[model samples]
Every structure is written in structure tokens, then in C-alpha cells.
Target: MSDTTSTTADRKLTEGTALPTQPCSVVWSDGRAFVLEPPVWVGLDHRGRLARLTPAALQRQGWSHDKLS
Candidate 1:
């Protein structure tokens, strides 16, 4: 049982450390939706408008942690 628990814990840690490489979806506070593609981090709005935001812009908008798989 102890070995099983250790294995489970290790598996959880490995899974938690992995970052997603695919495009993630995010929704702003004003009901606007966007899809953030990685590598370039370009945002595509709900209306199909493309907007490229820098890290500072993203931080200012407070969308640094709302990525959905």
C-alpha cells in the first residue's frame, strides 16, 4: 500500500509539471472570448478578430491564469 501511494504521488507530480503545447481558450471579464495560441501567443476574439498582445498587455488585462484546455 505504501509503494502504491508513492507511485500515485509521483504520477500526480509528473502530470502537474507538464505544460500544454496546444492552443488554449480564455474568456475575459466582459463576456468576450478569445483563443490564445502558443509560441506566438496571438489572441483570436470571438468575432474572429486577431490581436497580438505582449506579456505586459496580458498582465494588465489580468488574464494570466485563465487558460482552458
Candidate 2:
């Protein structure tokens, strides 16, 4: 038996490492809605809305953002 890990490029997108080009709708904690573009990271709350986020900001808020697939 051989033990090997397969590396696939397609999995990168689902891994939340890639940025999207199109605009995405996001909702803030106060029920405010907004749109964000690429290079900006965002996360969804329990209501399934895009919330503004950044690597540094998220770390402070203890929240994790996922890329739109």
C-alpha cells in the first residue's frame, strides 16, 4: 500500500483561498445590506448574509469568512 496525498487545484476555490470577481451581497449585524467585490473578505452570520470582513478584522472578531462558490 502506498500513502500519498493528492493535490488538486479545483479544491482551492472551495477552500476559501480564492477571490470572486462578481459583486456579492452582504448583510451586517444591524440588518444592513451591502455589496462587496474581490480582494475583500467577508463572512455570513446565522442569517446567511455577507458581512464585511478582513483577515485582521476577523481575527479580532473571532469570525471566519467563506468565499462564495
Candidate 3:
């Protein structure tokens, strides 16, 4: 099988590039809402700042992946 792993360089090139928008939301324990773009897993804060949701943070924050169709 061909190597399907993407290198850091490849990721860097695509990082911060806008893909097609698929807007969704996740909530904090305090009920703060964040707008997320799934498949990308990055989001925007209430003030409209970009938020990077790391795996560790997601688990710690009790986030579930709920895709909005």
C-alpha cells in the first residue's frame, strides 16, 4: 500500500486555508457557544477569534462530535 501519511510540511501548507464552510457548534460547561467547522475541527470563539480544539481539550471539556446536517 502507498504511504498515506501526511508530513508536517504538507499540513503547514494547508493550515489556516479556508475549506468549504460547514458551520456547527459546541458548548462549554458554562454554556458559552463556539462555532466550529467540522472535518477541520477548528472553531471561533464568542468574540470571533479562532479557537484550536486539541484532543486533550475536547475530552477535558466533555465535547462530543455532533455533525449538523
Query: lDDT for each of the candidates?
Result: 0.43, 0.37, 0.41
Model 3: clashing residue pairs?
Answer: none
Question: Model 1, which residues run further than 4 Å from truth?
Answer: 1-40, 67-69
Model 1, 1-69: lDDT tens digits are 353453344344434232334577453311334445664346565466877765344434434233222
Point out the higher-scoring one by lDDT: 1 or 3. 1
Which is better, 1 or 3, measured by TM-score? Answer: 1
Q: Which one is best on lDDT? A: 1
Q: Who is ahead in TM-score, 1 or 2?
A: 1
The pairs that clash in candidate 1 are: none
Q: What is the TM-score ranking, best to worst? A: 1, 3, 2
Cα-based TM-score, every candidate = 0.35, 0.29, 0.33
Compared with the true structure, model 3 gives a TM-score of 0.33
What C-alpha root-mean-square deviation, in Å, does candidate 2 show against the real structure? 10.9
Q: Any runs in candidate 2 off by more than 4 Å, and if so which? A: 1-38, 63-69
lDDT of 2 by residue, 1-69 (tens): 111111122233234443334668342222222335555645565477556665344333322132222
Give per-residue CA lDDT, model 3, range 1-69, as digits (tens): 111222233333334543324567553311233445564346555466767765345434433232211
Best by the TM-score measure: 1
